[model samples]
Target: MIEFKNVVKKYDNNITATNNISVKIKPGEFVYVVGPSGAGKSTFIKMMYREEAPTSGSIIVNEYALENIKSREIPFLRRELGIVFQDFKLLPRLTVFENIAYALQVIEKTPEEVEQRVSRVLDLVGLSAKRDNFPAELSGGEQQRVAIARAIANEPSILIADEPTGNLDPETAEGIMEILEQVNKQGTTVVMATHNSFIVNEYKHRVLEINGGKIIRDEEEGVYSNEDANA
Candidate 1:
């Protein structure tokens, strides 16, 4: 579970990225953080993973107090999270299978255990056939799927996706969405920061609309924007 209480993040030059935002995300829930560019969406998501610590406030993610957690402990905290980025951040030299296996390699998993975990996640993302392909060899959707596979290979309790479909075509984006949906269905809490209105409206979930560093609206099963709902 994730909880934020009076979370305020301020940067240099008197800029506030998050302003007294307090929210709680329960286990097994899919939540969307929808907002305009520079609306503090990325900053908000980064805070959860401790990429950018809050200037002042409390952020508890899966029981780790991020505001004051030691640097060494950050790795432990991240182990409990799966992060998928818009740009597929895969090692170009590594094949799809190796890319996923790399994530599990850091842990105490044996070679057999690594292969099994990689195979399971690749199967989950429907990319088992492309296991030997390199990132450069696959299409955009395929690479994204590989990224998702890499992320979830360790079975993190929480999955955080930041603009996961930003670079894909409509059809490809939908395919990616299906994979994410499947992941969520299997009980991983998903928190996605996205600007894709079609995906948000099509796949209804709890929506947190943020702007000017504040959560303006929090609606269950909400649309991408208020105007879309009215229209």
Candidate 2:
């Protein structure tokens, strides 16, 4: 579960990335954060993951007040959250298996536990066959699958994906969505930020639209309304 109340984020020179935004995502729910470029979607996701601190207001994720979270405690907070990015953020040198295993290793998991968890998640993402491959050796979608595998290997309670399908073809993107949906069905809360209207329309889930650093609309089983088509 995630909750934000009157959250604001401002950069130097008084440019606001998020302006007094409040939203809640319940457990076992799937939501989409929809917006155009510079609409504060990224900032919103970053705040949830503690990548950037909000300038004001409060954020409660899994019952921990983010404003009161100490710098030394961020790693523990992140242990309960899974994050994926548009760029696929895979290391070129590490094999797929190693990449996913690295996530567990950082948490001080034993080698046997790391191997078991990484193997299971890779199988879940249909990347078991490609575990020995490097990022450059895999296709875009495959690399993204590996990235997803890495994110979920530790079984985080919440999953936040930013432009997860940004670089893939339509079919590939759809495949990625299916995997995300499957993950959601298994009880991980999913919040995906995307600009793809076709996918949003097809999925027909809760949609939150943001513009000019504020959330403009939140709808259940929503479509992409083009009110800010020119924004």
Candidate 3:
């Protein structure tokens, strides 16, 4: 579960990325965040993951208040959340298995435990065959799947995907969505940020639309509702 209370994020020169935004996401729910460019969608996701601190207001994720979370405690907070991004942030030299295993290794997990967890998540993302491959060898979709596997390897309670399918073709994007849906079905709360209207229309779910740094609309089973012709 995630909750934001009167959250505000401002960059230098008084530019507000998020303006007094407040929202809540319940456990076992899947939600889509929709917005135009510069509408604060990225800032919102960063707040949830503690990548960007709110200038004001409070953020509570998986029961820990992040507004004032100590730097030393951030690792513990992140242990309970999974994060995926538009760019597949995989290390070029690391094999797919090693890439996923590195997350556990950082937390000082035993070698045996790391191997077991990496194996399970790679299987979950259907990338078992590519375990020894590097990121450059895989297709775009395959690379993203590997990224998802790495994120979920630790079994985080919440998953935050920021424009996860932004680089893939429609068919490949659909495949990634299926994996996310399956993950959500298995009880991990999923919050995804995307601008793809086709995917939005195809996989209808709760949508929160942001505009001008504020929540413009919140709808259950909603489609992309941007009024701009170019959107």
Candidate 4:
């Protein structure tokens, strides 16, 4: 579960990425954070994952209060959170298996454990056949599947994604969306920030709309569009 209380983030340029945002996401719930570019969606996700600190207020992710958490304790907090990015962020030279395994390895998982977990996640994402392929060798959607597999390799309690399907064609993006839905069904909380109206309208879920650095709407089984996001 995640909760934010009057959170604020202001950069040196005096641009406030997020301001007075408060919301809660329970375990196993799927929510979409929809907004146009520069609407603070990225900063909201970053704060949840501790990539950026809030300028004020509190953020709690699965019971860890991020306001005063030491830098050394971030890894432990991240152990319970999985992050996916728009870029796929895969190492060009590493094979699918290695890419996922590296995540487990970072947490000191043994080789045997790593191998088993990686194998399971690859199959989960329907990428078992591409285990030996590198990022460059795969199609965009396939590469994103590998990235998803890598993120869930640790069995994190929550999955946080930023523009997860931003790069793929609509059909390919739909495929990625299916995988994310499947993952959410299996009980991992999913928080995604997206601008794709088709996907948002088609796949009903909780929607939180942000603009001018604050959340203005939260609705269940919500529908969203870029135009509506600017309101």
For 1-231, candidate 2 gives per-residue lDDT tens digits of: 799999999998788999999999999989999888888989999999899999999999998889779998899999999999999999899999999998899999999999899989989999889889889999999999998998989998999999999899999999999999999999999999998888899988899999988999999988884555346
lDDT of 4 at 7: 97
Per-residue lDDT value at 216 in model 1: 87
Candidate topping TM-score = 4
Per-residue CA lDDT of model 1 for 1-231, tens digit only, reads 999999999999789999999999999999999888878899999999999999988999999999999999999999999999999899999999998998899877899999899989988889989999989999999999999998999999999999999999999999999988999999999999988899999998999988889998999998776553333
Query: Runs in model 3 with CA error above 4 Å?
Result: 225-231
Error of 2 at 28 (Å): 0.9
Please tell me which model should have the higher lDDT, number 2 or number 3.
2
Q: Local distance difference test, per candidate?
A: 0.92, 0.91, 0.91, 0.92
Distance from true location, Cα of 97 in model 1, Å = 0.7
Listed in order, each prediction's TM-score against the native is 0.97, 0.97, 0.96, 0.97
Tell me how far the alpha carbon of residue 97 in candidate 4 is from the true structure, in angstroms, after superposition: 0.5
1-231: candidate 4 lDDT, tens digit per residue: 799999999999999999899999999999999987898999999999899999999999988999999999999999998899999999988899999999999889999999999999999889999999889999999988998999999998999999899999999999999999999999999999999989989888999999888898999988887678555
Q: List the residue pairs that clash in candidate 1.
A: none
